[model samples]
Target: MDTHDLRLLANRIRRRDLQAVYEAGAGHIGGEMSVTDLLTALYFHTMKVDPAAPLDPNRDRLILSKGHTALALYVVLSEKGFLPKEEIATFLQHNSRLNGHPNRVKVPGVETNTGPLGHGLPVGVGMAKAAKLDGADWRTFVITGDGEMQEGSNWEAIMAAAHFGLDNLTLIIDHNRLQQGARLEDTNNLAPLPPKLAAFGWTVLEIDGHDMDQITAALSADNIASGKPTCIVAHTNKGHGISFMSDNVAWHHKVPNEAQYKQAMQELENAQ
Candidate 1:
């Protein structure tokens, strides 16, 4: 898909995500909305994986480290035909495989079970190292929330990635600025993330997270350095497409009431 189609697909995923959250009565909707574009660009535009053969050893791997926003990935996976689309409606329901966070065992496309904040990047490092050991060309991609970056585990993995020269690894930080209860700046500001990662010997690329063209280009294989991992600081807005919710801290985990849901859905509809 070109940039135009990718945007359209992203909007559709947002609509589906909003509906799922509203129906489920709970989700990390703010983060989900913020990360939709990144997830879309990866599954649709960048990664090489066949839905029918999701576990193919040669296929690229993706880890949504900011696992609270698993609904967004679940929607994208459904759109990618990794699972039945209707199963999304069962999100957060009793015994639904589509839990709040991804389950690698239950979900076809999910590479790992992620929900704890700081686990994804380190695990991603392991996957990338395995590929290196096997002399495989496949890449590993990990997306983590900005707030989640405060975890010491991520920084440890960052150093390890650079130490091992894992060039095939790309860590995308969803720099949305908001966390569960307040702004990340107010809570534990890790602003200026790029320089810190660069200081650790990783090549860092910064871009507007919502822009599909920038996203796809940044994720391109050409951008990876020969002996250093890549880190993309994707500046994004929480609740990105909805007027009332965009960048609002309150929406971090709040469900939209009927009126809010309608308005949000309308905005997403017009967004396409």
Candidate 2:
């Protein structure tokens, strides 16, 4: 898809995510909106994924480490034809496969079950390593929330990926600078994130996470460094698109009321 179509798809995913969160009465909305564009770019413009044959060994793998935002992934996957759009209404409902966090066992496109802060990269490293061992060309992409970087496990995975020379691995940090209840700077600041990743013997790229062109360029084949893992520090805003919710910490997991939901829907519906 072109950049223009990608934006439209992203807003559609955002609208679906917003309605699901409002209907479910619980979600990490801020992070969901922040990461929607990244996910859209990956599945639509970057990854070699097939909904018809999701288990193909040669397919590109994506692990959403910041799994609290699974609603966004669900919407994107639904739009990509991995699941029926009607099933999205079942999000968070009792016995629904579309739970708060993605379940690989239940969800077709999900690579693994992820919700804990720092597991995805390690899993991604392992997948990349396996592909390398088999001389497979498939790549692994992992997305983590910035706050989740505080987990020590991620640092260990960072070391492992570099040590293994898994250039097939790509870690995209959704650096919105905000977490569940506070800003990352107020907690454990991982600012100057690029230098840190580069120092660890990984190739680092920085880009505006919400920009489709930048995202596609950074993830392009020519940009993947030879013999080194790549990490992208994607600068983004919490609650990215909605006016009142953008960068607001309270929207981290706050469900919108009736009026808030309507306004939010209108804004998403009219997003350029």
Candidate 3:
């Protein structure tokens, strides 16, 4: 799909995500909205995966490191045909496989069970290293929130990725600048992330996270360094696509009221 189509898909995903969060009465909606574009570009345009062969050995791997936004991932998976769209209504329900965090065993497209911050990159590094050792062509991609970047484990994984020359690995940081209860700057500022990742010996690309063209270009493997991992610092708003919620920290896990829900849906529809 082209960038225009991708944007439309992303808007649709955002609408569905809003509905899911409102229906479930709980979700990391802010982060989900922030990261929806990245997820859409990956599943719809960048990644090489067959929904019918979910376990295909050569398929590209995507680990949603900031897994609280699993609702967004689930919506993308459903749109990509990994699961039935109707199953989305069961989100956060008792006995539903579509839990708050993604589980690899229960979800077809989920590569690893991720919820605890800072685990996905290490696992992605391992996956990339394995592919390298086996001379495989498949790649591994991991998306983590800016708040999650404070985890020392992610830096360790970053260092290790460089040391191992795992160019097949790509890490996209959703730099929404907000966490659960406060702005990332107010909690633990990790600004100017590009220099830090570049100092660690990775190729860094910074771009407006919501721009589908920029997102698709950044994700392309054409100009990647041969022996260095790539990090795309995707600068994004916390609650993207909605008028009142954009960049609002309070929306992190807040359930939208009926009026708020209607407004959010209208905004997304207008964007479409």
Candidate 4:
């Protein structure tokens, strides 16, 4: 899809995500909203995957490292035909397969079970390295929150990825600048992320995360460095697209009340 269509789709995804969070009475809605555009660009325009064959050996893998926003990933997976759309209503409900965190074993499109802050990148590195060893053309992509970067494990994975020359691996940081309870700057800031990644021997690209064109361009395989892992510092707002909630840390997991939900839905509709 082109950038315009991708934007519309992202808005729809945001609407659905809002409804799901309100219905479930709990979710990382702020982060979900912030990452929707990146997710939409990947599943729709960037990744090479077949919903009919979710486990295709050569399919590009996406690991949502910041799995607290699994609702957004689930919505994208459903839109991509990995699961039935009706299943979205089961989110966080009793005995639902769609839990708060993604489970690769149960969710067709999910590559790894991720929830604990910093595990996805390491797993992605392994996947990319395996593909390299097998001479496979598939790639591995991981998205982590800015706060999640504080985890030392992600830095270790970065070092390993550079050492192994896993150019096929891409790490996209959702640099929204807010965590669950506070701004990232107030809690262990990791600003100037581009320089840090560049110093680690990775090709880093910084862009407005919500811009569909920029997102698609950054994710294109043609931009991959020959022998260096790629890192995309996607600058974003915490509660993107929704008025009143944008960049507000309190919305991290706050359930929208009836009035708030309606307003959020209307804002999304107006954007459409």
After superposition on all C-alphas, the RMSD of every candidate to the true structure, in Å, is 0.6, 0.7, 0.6, 0.6
Model 4 has an lDDT value of 0.95
Residue pairs clashing, model 3 = none
Weakest lDDT window of 10 consecutive positions for candidate 4: 216-225
Error in Å for residue 241 of model 2:
0.8
- Total backbone collisions, model 2: 0
Model 3 lDDT per residue over 127-234, tens place = 999999999999899999999999999999999999999999999999999998888888999998999999999999999999999999999999489999999999
Candidate 4 per-residue lDDT over residues 1-272, each given as its tens digit:
99999999999999999999999999999999999999999999999999999989999999999999999999999999999999999999999999999998899999999999999999999999999999999989999999999999999999999999999999999999999788898999999899999999999999999998899999988889899999999999988989889999999989999999999999999998
**lDDT, candidate 4, at 257:** 95
The lDDT ranking, best first, is 3, 1, 4, 2
Q: Write the per-residue lDDT of candidate 2 for residues 21-103, one digit (tens) a residue.
A: 98899888999999999999999999999999999999999999999999999999999999999999999999999999999
**Please, what is the TM-score per model?**
0.99, 0.99, 0.99, 0.99
Give RMSD (Å) of candidate 1 vs. truth. Answer: 0.6
Candidate 1: Cα lDDT at 45:
94
List the lowest-lDDT window of 10 residues for candidate 3.
177-186
Q: How many residue pairs clash in each candidate?
A: 0, 0, 0, 0
